[model samples]
Target: MLKRYKKYSFLFQELVHRDFTKKYKRTALGIGWSVLSPLLQLLVMKIMLTKFFATGIEHYTTFLFAGNIVFNYYNESTSSGMTALAENSAIISKVNVPKYMFVFSKNISSLISFLLTVVVFFVLAALDGIEFTWKITMLIFPIVCLVLFNIGLGLVLSACYTFFRDLQYLYSIFTFLLMYMSAVFYDISAYSDFAQKLFLLNPIYLFIRYFRKIVMEQTIPTIWFHLLMILDVCIVMIGGFYMYKKYNHDFLYYF
Candidate 1:
């Protein structure tokens, strides 16, 4: 096998191109669907929940957009990453490319789409009369958190799905549940203090809350928030890398 960490740099361009082409192939409207899907969901959710949440949040649609962008990124990364390797079995058997490349490629694809959705969210937020402030720069930190967490998650899920084919379906259900549990559609602080503490333990909620604070509320993320995210990302990435490396060779047999 190629040396660990070497393959990411060597095969980066090829994997990115392959991932981009494969994603939009045979699809009508092509990449437009990426922007449309999240926007459509945001519209529907906003219309339905507006009456209930209208009291606290003046612009419910923008609130939904802020939260949905972060949630969609997490869901897409985890779901696609889980099946990335298994779906690329033909290439795996024929070439000597690193297995992690396939998983990383899927994540890159999802991140591209996520970035597109973020642009759309910003446009809608602007339309809603949300002013751009310097605090908007806080978005950069959460984006870095997203990348760090996703790379680690993609590695671990790709490795796990190699041994358990059923995991793909199970992961989908789990992701949906996680989405609701997160502060995606509603603010968790609205809950009791004990419930809020429990929710903060969820990394997904932490990512969303931080982004919403910066993008929608125009507030800077706290130092403690950045520190906690960094710690979480490091633990996940190191542990995931070790697991993926140990199981790298065995993945082909399952595929």
Candidate 2:
């Protein structure tokens, strides 16, 4: 894959550039919107949920940031990625290129947006009185795993979407429900042990929990926690890649 990426580096870069062009072109704030958008969402969510849910969590705002950032990245990446092949149907039908290139570029754009706000998250954490640790460095592990996880899942979704346009509507609803399932503001300690384990079944929740454990709790997650996150990535990536290989040709028909 690295060799393929190197072979097609120029096209990949252009796809990324085009994504930025389409998203920020003629906008006043330009890239500044990347930072501001998530903060605005954080503001809205905090306003709505803090009173009811912030009761016991220390540094509730920071906790909210942790969930909002991770979930939004997943949302944006997969949403754009769902249309990767279809959006570039012109280019794909006319030229021979790796379809995954479009999806990768889309994910990269979403990742850039997420990283900008990560800077704000750190600054906010400092002001909110959360102590930092070297474990903060390990936060990148979950971020990296999440990028791969998104790509894998993006592959599956884009494949499915080519054949079923209604998937787009269904996905919006799923993500809406996913926001709450991710425990963006709620503390899940109130749940029974079995229910607690069920929350870990959600890969997004696992990543959010990782951030919370590091940023708010100032601790590293156990080995099992890391493995579980990786396991989720592996399963999803394998499934996505397989789905694409099987259906790549069929995508042309639906497009």
**Top lDDT prediction, candidate number:** 2
lDDT of 2 by residue, 24-132 (tens): 9999999999989988988998999989999888899999999999999999999999999899999999998899999999999999888988999999999999888
For all candidates, what are the clash counts? 0, 0
Each prediction's whole-model lDDT (CA): 0.82, 0.93
RMSD of 2: 0.9
Residues 78-139 of candidate 1 have per-residue lDDT tens digits of 78888888888998989887777787888888889998988888899889988889888778
Model 2 TM-score on a 0 to 1 scale: 0.98
TM-score of each: 0.92, 0.98
How well does candidate 1 match the true structure in TM-score terms? 0.92
Lowest-scoring 10 consecutive residues by lDDT in candidate 2? 244-253
Clash count (model 1, backbone only):
0
